[model samples]
Structure formats: structure tokens, C-alpha cells
Target: MTQGLSTPRLAALASAPPRPAPPPGEAVERCELCAEPVRDGHRHLLDLEEGEPLCACGACAVLFDGQAAGGRHYRLVPDRRRELAGFHLDGPLWAGLGVPVDLAFFSVSGTGEVTARYPSPAGALHAAVHAASWRRLAEVNPVLAELRPDVEALVVHRARGAAEHWILPIDDCFRLTALLREHWTGFTGGEAVWRHIDAFFTELKRPGRPPRR
Candidate 1:
């Protein structure tokens, strides 16, 4: 009877959703936009309408820099990565957002609407935030008020009585989401996932000039 009971549990586990794939190998390649050969360090552009990321040579990325171009299809992903020092969200404010996860990314959409997404065991889970909440957040950090629509995000992670906030490119947000979906295990993401998260933050916190406030 023990073996019979275990068989059903195994079958249920087999039907669960698959995890996100690991990060791809890093090698120089052609630009997705101009087809010009680009190095692994080439800049990226975000196709706002389609919500797709495009690898681009520097020249191609420059072409889409100005938002006033009015095409509404493509937006250049800004390279500015910033750490918001002394950022805090009280418990009541956190509860208002309704995100169960401790990490989340917030970005403005093509239509000038702010949205928040958190990584989950299944995939990126989006939670619609009220406009008033966004306004309040902007009041605290005006830099966040200037986040490029669809192409950039303000990522915040609150855990263990500490919080870290970064203004990051949208693609990086997706990368983190992929990481969580792949290696997360049990309630606390297991050992492997925590290691990966730590390494990622180390890169973000490297010694360099902070982004302009």
C-alpha cells in the first residue's frame, strides 16, 4: 500500500509545469536588428509593442534613443543601473501591493501604465498596482519616475529586515525571473538558488560610480 500511494504522488509531480531554461552561452554574434556582427557586450533594445528584447549594435541602439520619435514600437534599453540607497517600504505599504513574493519588478507599459511582476514557481506573475501606489513610490524616488516605458524597470527585493532596490533594464528582470523559475526549490529556493541570487547581486553591486540621482 505504501508503494501504491507513492506511485500516484510521482505521477502528479510529473505533470507539473517545467522550469525556465538556464542562461545561454556567451559568444559574439550578429545583431538581431542590423545583422551586423556584434560582440557579446552589445547593447539591447526592447520592442515595447511586442514585449520582445532585441540584441543590437551600438549604432542600432542609438537610433531608438529618443522617445519623441513617436513610432511607439521600439525603445532603447537604458544602460543605467542604480542602487537606491535608504529605500524602505512599510508593512502596510507592502501589503497593499498584494505580491506574495519578496522580489518584484515595476515598469511602465507602452500606454504609460505602471505594472509590477514577481517571479513564481510557474513563471512571472503580474500584479496590477493602483495608480496611487505608483505615485507614492515616485514621490520618494523621482529617478524612478523617469523609468523608460517597457524597456526599464525598478526592481526591489525585501527580505530578512533589509531591502535592496535597483533601477535595471527590463531584460535583466526577465533573466532574474528565469533564474528563479529554474533553480527554486521548496519554500526558500534551496541552496543552489540562493547562491545564484547572491552572485547576481554581487555583479549589480560592483565597485563603480553610482547612477545619477
Candidate 2:
């Protein structure tokens, strides 16, 4: 006679944690609302119901600026980008959040759950984070309190071994995703990709805010 495994143990072994659906890649590239042709450099609006970043031409984007009226169905992603000066985070704090990568962006989704995503060759690789850990960090960095739900994120990078944080629009986060996907090579991202990444952050650090043209 052989002993059988317990039901709870068997059930636990059978189940695997679910992955967040990698957001729709290359969504329409053009304004989804008015069918206007959006340029490569364009703004985006969060399609609240669908939970996807919808491409929007300047005109259409302006319509939903701040908050979308009439039930808040859509919210325009702003152009704001600010480096979080003297942002604080240590190895233990970051590891406790449970993100597999050293560099990841944290944001809240439309339905109000925190999302931990990192740029990778595959895309923005989504991972589950410990909510309690995030709460602890938010207490230390009050700036986290200002993060806009869904359309904005707190992007942190320790790529060079020095932690850098930024409050950037969600669209910019996707741009980083696209950059990594296109230039990344096997295992470690190639030197070319690293240079590109450096340049991207350099531009972000450039003085003077981008004018609202």
C-alpha cells in the first residue's frame, strides 16, 4: 500500500500563479477616438474600461486632459516628467517588494491594484508585488502619494548600481519598453542598447521642462 498526498498539498502543487496579461502591444498607433492620424510622437489616453493606453492625436488628447468628463471613461496621460531628486530606496526595501528585476516601474491600475512592470526584450514584463511593501515605501517617500492612478508611474532604475527614480507619464514607460524590445540582445542587453538607455535618461535629466506647444 502507498500513502496518498493530501488534497490541499495536491491542489497547491497543481496551481501556478497567474501572470498579468502583457498589455496589447502596438495598439492602433493612431487616435482611436476620432480616427485622426497620430504621429510617432503622440500622446495617449487611458481607456478606463479596457485598461489599455489608447493612442490619441493632440486634439483628441486635449479633450480628455486632467479627467475625462461624463463618468470618467478616459484620462489623458500628461507630458510631465520629473526626476525624483534624492529618492531613497535600499536593496532590502526593493527586494521585499518582490519584483524579480532591479529596475521596475510601479503604478496603480484603473481598478486600483498596484502593478510592477519592468522593461525587457519581451515587453513590459509584469510581476506581482507585495502591497504591504509598497505601503512601507510610500510612507518613506511622500512623493509616491502624488502618483496618478493608471496614467502615471514611479519608475526606478539601479541599472548603474546607483538608484534613480522618476515620476514619468505611463506612455514614456512604454517607450522604454519598446526601446528595450528592439535593441536588446541575448542575456545581457548589448552595448548599443545600454548606450540608448543612457541617452534616454540623459534627455530626461536635461534642464527645463518641455514646453506645452
Output the number of the TM-score-best candidate.
Answer: 1
Model 2 segments more than 4 A misplaced: 1-30, 37-41, 68-72, 120-123, 208-213
Candidate with top lDDT is 2
How many clashes (backbone atoms < 3 Å, residues ≥3 apart in a chain or on different chains) does model 1 have?
A: 0
Residue-wise C-alpha lDDT for candidate 1, range 60-109, written one tens digit per residue? 87787787552777777777787888766777667766677788888888
Clash pairs, candidate 2, are: none
Stretches of model 1 off by over 4 angstroms after superposition: 1-27, 208-213
Model 2 Cα displacement at 161 (Å)?
A: 2.2
Estimate the Cα RMSD of every predicted model relative to the unseen true structure: 9.4, 11.5
Candidate no. 2 TM-score:
0.75
lDDT of 1: 0.68
